[model samples]
Target: MGVGLYLHFPFCQQKCNYCDFNSYAGMEHLLPKYLSAIKQELFLYKVHVSVVNSIYIGGGTPSLLAINDITTLFDSIRRNFYVADRAEVTMEVNPGSCTLEKLKVIKMNGVNRLSIGLQSFNNESLKKLGRIHTVEDFIRTYQYARQAGFDNINVDVIYGLPWQTGEEWQDTLAGVVELDPAHISLYSLTIEEGTPFGRELKAGKIKKIDEDLEAEMYENAVKLLKANGYEHYEISNFAKPGKRCLHNQIYWRNEEYVGIGAGATSYMGRVRYTNVKEIPLYIEKVFGNDYATAEKEALKLDKIIGETIMLNLRLLDGFRMDDLTKRFKTNIDQLYGPTIKVLSNQGLLKEEAGMLKLTDHGLMIANQVFQRFV
Candidate 1:
């Protein structure tokens, strides 16, 4: 019953070509500005979250900061909010930048979870993704995190890259499974319109992998991870029992969380809001002690129910129709019964043990299911 807190660290050693998130390179001069502004923004929202169950420090690359500044950020959170004793405090680290000493200080400052970006086991794949670190760097970073006493860690990887053969994908899956990290995130590459990948694709310089191959890659991930005892809790995330990312679950479950820093998002009281995407504008507003909401919308009536169905369905366990009925005080059958019946008949949805959930087929074409609700 605790709130979740998300902090964005916008610094990066170098921006990846596939990334469109509001992270910056050559921004060392702005680090002090970001830190000061982030603290003020936290204070602005201090009234909402008194007890936090999770805190995630994500970024262009959060590990790019000095350990002392990272500690200060955590300290500011504690100074303003009461983090639960066992809260999942996580920080995202890139393989290139993390060091043993820094990880130890991060642990000492109360980070219990570490998420390392290890996009692939193959050096060529890593190069294609514009990752600065090599396979050996990831191995060293992982070992150091363990030596620093991190038992819970997550590794991030991507599939569906150009020239990624099935054999290569299988080799990657085998390597990652052998490591047995607490969590793994398997993402499909998405080429955003303004990114380098996008331009290359538009110019016929790069080609996407076959759709069938992409689907098979996902299938392989699900099969291999589950066979190894990792629960496919979310479409992209696999975790050992009782180790699902509490912070990200706050997102998938559509619960309330406050986000701090540029381009961050927040959801609370049935309202969703986003901060300024540009760092300079975000820093200016927050440092001036003003609210940094660049866009906001209050979800009510149909919007709330629609959003609930869309988000909660992402969880494998799914949400109960009865709870949705009680919360919004409407009969679920009256509102969505026909849509449900049609989808169930199409083999995309099923109701079991009084809960409505997407079938494996549904997860494969999850967008179709979402479209029905909207």
Candidate 2:
């Protein structure tokens, strides 16, 4: 399989309060220079990566780019790499940031998928989350994307907000399901240390939702999405049959991928590396040296085996035991037999028909199961 490509656009119009990603607000002035630096960075990897099966343009909000900028980015990609003829090219868009003209231009430039960030349908919840767009903006964006000829669309939603209720959560799920997009991603809110929510949490001004409530929300999502004809393929993702996000599957399967842009991480040749997080520094380094790698680590065999298991278990279908053994040229039973046995006894994991997978119960506390391997 060809390697997957990920390009990060690290700018947002207004940073969300709960986000801890390496994205900045009030940085639109750097868009042109930043894109140019990305092109230069891609050139450095041309020899190492010859073919790409997927291209994911994720961000702070990639839809913030101007038409010319979008055109230039794709032109650079085609010039530096051999993107597959049927490659899955996806771009992330914030509801209010994208216009019909921009969506049409994006489709014309070869983006086959659009992941819209529509955190919640409740106007109050949107305000609490620091989202600039309203429910109306999202509906407009979705309609415009359809009119622009994009059939494969993914809607992203978050549960467990500061004052969110079960009824509100249910409404958001129902609204998105009614739209019937090709894919859906449900994310539980995490209050990261440096984010506004975190500070409020520390100051006793905001509280994390009760753990039991969060779990209930997740379980409800699984049941609802499954009944609505969506497959629970990964922990936080669901898709209609044959509509899974191929780019993310590469990560879950522990396959090779190349990531471009500031703070993006890439794994190739069993070595993982991340580019610099600061946008200005990233651009300067890339323009000056054609590279901006800030960290790199080469995995040892045992580490790779453990990490591979941790990653593959994210897939609901599980990984084949035979495939693991063949790839590592070792006995799977010998390495994790005792651990697997204990987990299986606790009903957190199961092995059958030459495949190992998480049980329904295991999906709830998957982090703990993964810890046993890693």
Candidate 3:
């Protein structure tokens, strides 16, 4: 089985008010050390990983990385890893950070896919979300990416923003459909505890939208994107036929992948581990050849099965019971037979074709079903 490689870039021009990702705003100066440490971490893999089918350069805006650093990162990957010829290499780009010159260089250096984070089409919503890019800037950057010869594109949009009207939400969907990107990721806004949005929410300065309103927005997205020829392949992802994200699918399938760079996580064999989040410490440790590993856990069989059930349920196509039994040596029902039966009785889940999947209503309150397994 081929592995997926994830490299995290934790530098951004500014942090979004809602972002809780392990990214820093004024840490651009740490790029060189971070890149070198990532390269070293790549060689530290002891397992005999033969081929890689996907490489996702994700994070605090990978497009902001210097061209030379980008080239060096890819060059090291090519030299050390047997990357497949048609591997889906994706990089996340933000509108304000991407330039034609930089994007072209990244594209030419083996990046076939670009995921642009365009949270909203409304300039007012963009400002409210503390996003640096305007609607026009996103348009220009997207057009520039296409001009740079990227055919496989994904656009990420968020709905249910504070005080967002249905008309505004529909406009955002229409704008994305007009772009016709190969893939689209639609998400409802969630308030994380430490984010500015969360603080504002706690202070009663900002209010969370009603659950019914959020559900309506989500349902609208499903209908609109499906009508536009995009398949709702995952709970939050839609793709044109054969354009589903392979890297993310690996995770959904509960397969192993090595995540490199600061604040990265890796799942190899039965163990799951994460790298140190602190940049200076990560650099020092990797340079010291300790791989900057912060913590590691050998997941128990029950926990693994719980993870399998939780992750696979997110996919629309679902997963095979026979395959899980083959891999984990555990019967399907033993893992969550009682819970599945309860959910099925409640019309939150359905079983057919030797596979189990979430129902339409189940998708609305997926967290409730997911919590049972956890």
Report lDDT (CA) for all predictions: 0.90, 0.94, 0.90
lDDT of 2 at 57: 99
Candidate 1 deviant stretches above 4 angstroms:
none
What are the models' TM-scores? 0.98, 0.98, 0.97
Q: Write the per-residue lDDT of candidate 1 for residues 1-374, one digit (tens) a residue.
A: 67899999888888787888888889889988889999899989888777989999999899988988988888889999998998999999999898999999999999999999998999998887888999999999999999999999999988998889888988888888898999999989988999889999999999989999999999988999999999999889999998899899888877789888899999888888999988889999987779899999898767778777888888999889989888888877787889889999999999889888999899999988998877
What's the true lDDT of residue 150 in model 2?
95
The candidate with the higher lDDT, 1 or 2, is 2
- Residue pairs with colliding backbones in model 1 are none
Q: Candidate 3: lDDT of 209?
A: 91
Ranking by TM-score: 2, 1, 3
Please give the distance, in angstroms, between residue 318's alpha carbon in candidate 2 and its true position after superposition: 0.6
Evaluated against the true structure, the overall lDDT of model 3 is: 0.90
Q: What's the CA RMSD for each of the models?
A: 1.1, 0.9, 1.2
Residues 1-374 of candidate 2: C-alpha lDDT, one tens digit per residue: 58999999999999899999989999888888999899998999998998999999998899999999999999999999999999999999999999999999999999999999999999999998999999999999999999999999999999998798898999999999999999999999999998989999999999999999999999999999999999999999999999999999999989899999999999999999999999999999998976799999999877888889988999998988789899889987788878889999999998767779999999999999999998
Best by TM-score: 2
Give the distance in Å from residue 260's predicted Cα in candidate 1 to where it truly belongs: 0.7
